[model samples]
Target: MDPGEPDPEPGRIEVLRRRLAQRHGERLFAEGALGPRRDLAGVLAYVLALLVHGVTVALVVAGLLLVVLGWGQGALPVIGGLLLGFAVVLRPRFGRLPDDTPVLRRAEAPQLFALIDEVAAVAGTTGVDAVVVAADANASVTTYGIRQRRMLHIGLGYWEILTPQQRIALLGHELGHFANGDTRRTAVIWNALHSLALWHYFLAPVPEPDLVERITNWVMTPPRWAVYGLLHLLDQLTLRSTQRAEYLADEASARVGSTDAAAELMDRMLVLDSVEVALQRESVIAQTKGGAGTRRETEQGLWERLAARVESVSEREYERLRRVSVLRGHSADATHPPTHLRRRRVSEGEQWQAAVRYDEERAHAIAAELAAARDRVARVVISDTAC
Candidate 1:
């Protein structure tokens, strides 16, 4: 399947969910919980603050102009306030206090750096300068490369939702992004040309619902249509860049983790989309994939395969991620990319068990060690007499 293209597999999700539920609990997505990143939160605050301030200032300017037309200064305040509210619905505000969550790198957890280093080794890439877990569940590998800035940001949502193995799988994907250098900042030049064309050509809002007013409106709204049209056009032109990048990332994931690990993650996301679509289907938007049961399970995995493929993460880790993978909510409000989608694309599915060479002995060792670590963390949390 082309990367990013939708090819919903049949019966795969239900089975995966069952498999995960049996091993781990369901993924929990509590409302108002931290799933979006803090940068977005800060970005929104700063950006919207500027937009609002701009609109407020603009309204003051507009109102003063109105005063020259004989509208009293007394009426200006009310007019300015209403204009500010109206501006809220204008072009997508890049600033909104993203969901609140603490930074992971700065968290009290001592194991973060070691975990990052371990991931870098597994991924065959140098470790990042720092690592952080955002309040959100999303994770990203961002870098433009060579003297350009490169950084990986993982949302707390993934940390919360994934088991250690899944987390390992996820980290592989992001590091792949860093390793692959997914930043398209270089595309800015082309994008600028596109925007210039849009500004001169189609950069006008729909002027006519019908007739002359629509034409007039289209002619009048330059900034709005310029921004909106450029965005729409980029989705079409840049999609190939995006798809290819995603494919590369998936390949990176396969190299770092077993192909099957990637496959399981994909299946996990397929289940998430299925469940979400199921809910939306019932919720009246009614957008759900029809036709279940007749589909064949061609993707990969059938229990034993999953065991060998997921060896990087302990069985315990799989159980933990599966338990939490039952994450819910739309990705609309998300600052982080959807794990369901990223993991699936990165799976690059091809039977991987043949190559995994599982160590049942090591699994046992890691399980015992991790169990002890959990107990120690619990003790630390509990012994804190200071609330």
Candidate 2:
């Protein structure tokens, strides 16, 4: 490297980061071996996360001490107050579920809830408190509020395309997050990371539209970069553990949904782009219909049509997608390990027979329960596409 050469762009740096993370992950989980041990790197990451939270607590304590000791001093009281206010403003938050999310209660979707419960039990986790449907081609399990009530978010765009067994695999994988030793998901670590992220966001420089704003940004730049570096360090420390959690989640998926089904789910993930395209096409077609009544009628069968389109995806196309995934080192996201690695790992282990099973009758009953959510999601998709 030349001394005078500029540093890589942020996008290039991120790509390099991901590549390094992936290499570390591949080395950690060689040949799909699942050992019951935490590596030194994972332990260090966990300790660092704890230390971050401890620092926050220390800050609060120091602020209080300053307020008490400097009761009569003008400058000291103001400094103490500023510190207290900063702590309050940057406090860790338990995020709320979006109001627009189409949530399904157990009472309204007993059959669906039952299936999820069975999958949860098989995956060694408890049943979710609520199930929400969305329009993206993804699914996840998360906790909400101080109570940490569990919630499952299923993307209709993805769910509508999967086989019944694949759906069970998806549920098992998500519920597995609870059982997996995913340090990042733990309250202490998650909140610490969240607070740091918030600090980074607040400290970041905005567009300098005026001299005063420019000065403020210039003053803020050093602290912003400091926070950015810290965040990246923490992320690097936890990268391997996070990736390991994903593989463990895949194992859970296989345990409850069978290895074949779980592997098929990975293949499905590889072609999610095609799924998105089909969904957009459907949305556009619905919008093109002459009247609101016609569009609504089309929306009602949207899921069925989408399902058929996905089902119609040929083996040749699937193979092509798999090859593409391999070539591109495709992953669900930067946080996840590569798709091909996950797929290979799940299949390499002793083929897991499903502990839980799904039948057409049960599948139908679950779909019946999700009917309202499907319609609502369809409407949302169409509305967004029209706009």
Candidate 3:
């Protein structure tokens, strides 16, 4: 669909979805509102963790500076250790899937039924409730309510690859989230708080009692590499959160289809005009060498790696993916796991696929509000066309 076209009612779209979701007498879900609260404890725990991580890291940095500067001898490592501890904890980013739009629609493909049926059996659930394609750039799969609105986002690059079977197989994994609603719902609060933590990310400074102001200032002064290191650490943590989510999705996919399918899909998507993965890496390797011969060699290595990862898919397909950002400039900070990592874990069969129970109180309560975001997704992309 041209992102410019106005969408039909999501509730109406839900009707088309019902046909796709309920093939085979499957217990299809249709809810979109937010679930009830259960992640409170999980969120609280993480908050406590951040507090602890921050305080401890500050102390350790202080201790290290004291010793290195000879302000104190034995206490330096101890203090540094405290600061490092907090740094380690606070530095790692975590969050739940942000509340976003999820569009539910039917498979125009007649063959979609078999794939749905197969996954339904694996998921031990009826219908997937919806087949979601992210209206935007991010790639994610999230389920809300009893049959869940199974939202699966693909980068424009990813949609370019794949036979119909591949798409259905990918969708099957989203169905896994519905079946594994148990696990997903359980993680919701952990996710919500994590999401909140990220949404409100800041270096607002340590509380007075644990201030690392003096040391933090010194370390960050003089164009400190430590500041850069800390930023990298945060990015790494964010990447990990996304990676974990992919692990969960891969595991879900493998349970219904072959690990190879999931792995291939992920690998293909990673390099497909992923400026972060493909262009950015190429640029970095080139700069690292800074000589014509060396630059060529570095780019060649990156090219070969990217080419091998997507050998099954054609360059023309990726070229199509490049179209996604043709009107835009390079983006920074990819929110998904690296394609290579996603491929490896899926191929190996991750632990995240197993069935877990959804917390009804939490999931059900959130369903109504959740649907609002779905409605927005069904509507907003029309305007983004201009953007």
Best by TM-score: 2
Candidate 1: 10-residue stretch with minimal lDDT: 294-303
Residue 126 miss distance in model 3 (angstroms):
4.5
For 153-201, candidate 1 gives per-residue lDDT tens digits of 6543233334445555666667755554322323332333333333434
Off by over 4 Å in 3: 1-102, 105-114, 123-126, 134-139, 144-157, 179-248, 274-338, 345-387
Tell me which of candidates 1 and 2 scores higher on lDDT: 2
List, residue by residue over 148-227, the lDDT tens digit for candidate 2.
89889999888888998899899999999888888677676677777777777888777745888888999999988877
Q: List, residue by residue over 118-222, the lDDT tens digit for candidate 3.
A: 556765656544444443333445555543344445432243244333444465555654554332233433343343343234332334534567666454454
Task: Give candidate 1 regions above 4 Å deviation.
Answer: 1-99, 106-110, 121-124, 129-137, 142-152, 183-216, 221-237, 273-387
Q: Of the pair 2 and 3, which is ahead by TM-score? A: 2
- State which candidate, 2 or 3, has the greater lDDT: 2
Off by over 4 Å in 2: 1-17, 36-40, 54-89, 206-222, 288-290
Instruction: Write down the TM-score of every candidate.
Output: 0.41, 0.85, 0.37
Of 1 and 2, the candidate ranking higher by TM-score: 2
Between prediction 1 and prediction 3, the one with superior lDDT is 3
Q: Output the lDDT of residue 179, model 2.
A: 86
**Highest lDDT scorer:** 2
Please, what is the whole-model Cα lDDT of each candidate in the order they appear? 0.41, 0.81, 0.42
Error of 1 at 65 (Å): 21
